[model samples]
Target: MTVQTIPAPAAPLRVTPASPLFLREDEIRRGIELLYFGYTAMIRGADAILEAQGLGRAHHRALYFIARQPGLSVGELIGLLGITKQSLGRVLTELQARALVEQQVGTADRRQRLLRLTKAGAALEARLFGELERSMARAYGEAGQQAVTGFWAVLMGLVPPDDRPRVEALQA
Candidate 1:
């Protein structure tokens, strides 16, 4: 007797409010306001520390991402940060001068520069993350698991369709 294999069923479509359905201006405005406030609140802690170090949000963002992705190429950073080369060059120069970051020529491609954080950079990144974590932890704890999951889905949905894969890859 010969046995045939059965294919698994396809996943069901997920319908969300974020879908391309019509939305009221008032609702959209509310979401925009919430995003503004959330962003401001999240950065406030890190901003204080960065300010004291003569750094700004841009510097902190670079440090945070570099710490997340060690040995990331200069081009990769520019793509991820979505900033102009000039802006990134300025930030990198500052970071290099401070000895917080180091760059090495890629083995495979001599022209490509791989970026890594120094011991000092890691320590500062940890300190910066600590403050932000405290705030997020408190908010997440209050929101509970379900809300947290939904919140992440909403945030991820905000990313452009073309850029979603890149952002999701970073999560991995």
Candidate 2:
């Protein structure tokens, strides 16, 4: 005798009108407005901390991520950030000119350069951590654990599967 088994039904996803995704046209418009406001406020907060140090978000991203994983290749950074080659080149030039980053010739590949944060760059990263962590902590405190987890889940959903490991490695 042969037996056949049926797969179980998938669980339903929970979403609300306030969620930018499932909302109707009018609701989506309102949600977009809120998102714009929130993003603007967050950038403003970040800028306030960054401006004093003469560093902007782009430099901050490079410094922080490079410090997180020293010796990460330029190719790896470009892949993780998903920016155009020209845009990344400009940022790299700025960082290198400032002596915040150093490029070492790849051991195996002569043409390839591996990037690392210089001592100054690592110090800047360590300094920025306090302010960044405080801001994020305050946001999490206001949002609560469930909201924070949900927000992370929504963000992770936006990323492709193959890119998830790179993001997770940074988090680690």
- TM-scores, all models, native as reference: 0.85, 0.71
lDDT of each: 0.83, 0.73
* 1-172 per-residue lDDT for model 1 (tens digits): 1212322224322323454643778668867987899889988998889989999888888998999999999999999999999999999999999999999999999999999999999989998998787777766655555666887988989998999999988887
- Give the poorly placed runs of model 1, Cα more than 4 Å off: 1-22
Off by over 4 Å in 2: 1-22, 25-31
The prediction achieving the highest TM-score against the true structure is: 1
**Local error of candidate 2 at 107, Å?**
3.0
